[model samples]
Target: MAKPVLLNNITHQHLRVRTGPGAEFGDNQMAAPIIAAEFRQAQAHYPIVFRPTAGDGFEALALFGLAAGDNLFLSNDGWDADYVPLAVRRQPFLIGVSGQELTVHVDEDSARLRCGPDEGEAVFLEEGSPTPYLEQVNSMLFALHEGMLEMTGLIAALREHALLEAFVFEIELADGSERRLEGLYTINEEALAALDAAALDRLHRAGYLLPVYMVVASLSNFRALIERENRRYAVPR
Candidate 1:
């Protein structure tokens, strides 16, 4: 679905990406895939929850809203959160495989990309090299790539331990309307606490304990999500 093209001066000398947020580029429903490497940071701001993938096992995500097309984080002003996930940060650009090398590819149809140099941030320097903004995007992409690679093993650990459990969230809006959010999973703390000594040691040795606990700790952010929603609906607009 993405019309990605290799980022090159000849074909994209006028590339500029819009700065700030407000879902200007139609990214209102950005799904922030939280990885173990960023659990500490992500847990501070977003509710880290696991969602099942189609034959791909589970993925940890920072909950941006209660449902699709409802990113409570985005407003006319900008993103409300302090920490934006790496997946959401790398917009309009992606890592492309060219032989054995990874190159930058820009989404040609992205609303973020502009034709004029006067607005947004330039992708390339006036002298033809990558700009600082592009460099940052490159770093974000590489980090996200590596983080995703690490998530496979982390999720496997949880699955192998049988720690994943299904959950459903029922919410009551300010107007007294009730909605149910389903098909989510969470780490089973009871089973985690029931693990034998050797099993605990194995998880600790594998550096899995912290992320598991991080997920447990992040569940509290659901309260934050509720607060944001309440505020959004409470407004006259």
Candidate 2:
């Protein structure tokens, strides 16, 4: 749970956040929600796909590993990938909404939080003000909040046009085993292409076309994910 970080929280001691990936910090999440703002860059690294939500709605995620509880990018040296998802980058700290305003919430039990210095990122200065690190987190939170609003609107537009279709991913592993991912959804290129001029205009007016194509383009990165897995296979066990 997050207690509202206030002057008392900072003045008494320090908010030290251990930087890097670790089980204690909860970076072990295999998939994370991402937005249109990140899709272009995320496409370069991970395969961005949409997963069905409980209410038949769709949400986008960046797939990190072939199996559950696996994150191929994580290592002793921190995240091995060149680009980390925005949701992953903003760990321990989350955005809270009070009516129309947003507040920053820090998970007290997070491994990122440390009472004192043991080689960790400080959330606040000794003088009780935001540090550069905390400032960056704030920026990320704001960007995420804004980006997600756009993402939600675009997804609704896709749904309006019936452009999303359920998909299944099948991979034949190096050991001759098969891995399957289901309950995922992707844009139907044919459906998108079949859109009438007026329908296309509506999507364009909502700034949805770019992101729709970005999600489609990201599927190619699945090959790169398999390559990452194959590297581990090359090592003598």
Candidate 3:
């Protein structure tokens, strides 16, 4: 497992926590470390990860070392002072690339927005006027549809009977309250298999799995039987 490292101390409100690895240089990609000083005091470190980006920009990812569990507080990055509560009620967990821009539907009745990606440096969308939170709600629903599809792929690859059965996750709220989420949701394999390409595309267009990241697997944590199989297939060079 990679240990967390300190990145910065400044708490800029516009900070966005995205899912992509930072800029590429030559053939190497930079490690996106966390800024500890801003959120955690000088004492014990909070279970948070920070990745500093170009120009004073930064992104945060909270971790609780959960395997197979769902995280509800992952949407803290998309929270706004006025609409965060509404967002929390709808969908608490989020899955996507860490730093990609997101377009939010601000008006419930009209798809037009008061603001756009160009106006803000972060990954949220808003309108000049306040419509019922319903518009923003729809946007979130759309995003979640996509997120589930991308997450399903990762989950499917990890669902071997001997590999894993449970999960643990961390949830970080806007008010700085962090909670752990751990549970089991019956994997509906039949339903997942029935999904058609068009349904999958709708999820993708809604920004569920944009900016793909690596599907991480821990060799050290694999079951002994699985490890033996991996060794059997290992290429001898």
Global lDDT scores for all candidate models: 0.83, 0.81, 0.30
- Highest-scoring model, TM-score: 1
Better of 1 and 2 by TM-score: 1
Which runs of model 3 end up more than 4 angstroms from their true locations? 1-133, 160-237
User: Following a full C-alpha superposition, what root-mean-square deviation does model 1 have from the true structure?
Assistant: 2.0
Write the candidate numbers in order of decreasing lDDT. 1, 2, 3
TM-scores for all predictions: 0.92, 0.90, 0.22
Residue-level lDDT of model 3, residues 1-237, one tens digit each, is: 122221111321222222211111110111112221212220121122332335533333333122223322123343211212212333212223435643332121211212344441232224233234434444555555564445344333323222123345444444444545444222233444455797556535644222111111111222322333244346779
lDDT of 3: 0.30
Model 1 poorest 10 in a row by lDDT: 22-31
lDDT of 1 by residue, 1-237 (tens): 679988897677768888667565765773567778889988897878898887878888888887777788898778877888877778888887778788989888887875466888988887788899989999988887787778888888898888999999999988677667788898999999989999888888988889999999999988888888888668585
Q: At residue 167, what lDDT does model 3 achieve? A: 42
What TM-score does candidate 1 get on C-alpha atoms?
0.92
Worst 10 residues of 3 by lDDT: 21-30
Q: Give the Å error, residue 181, model 3.
A: 10
lDDT of 2 by residue, 134-163 (tens): 899899999999987777788889888888
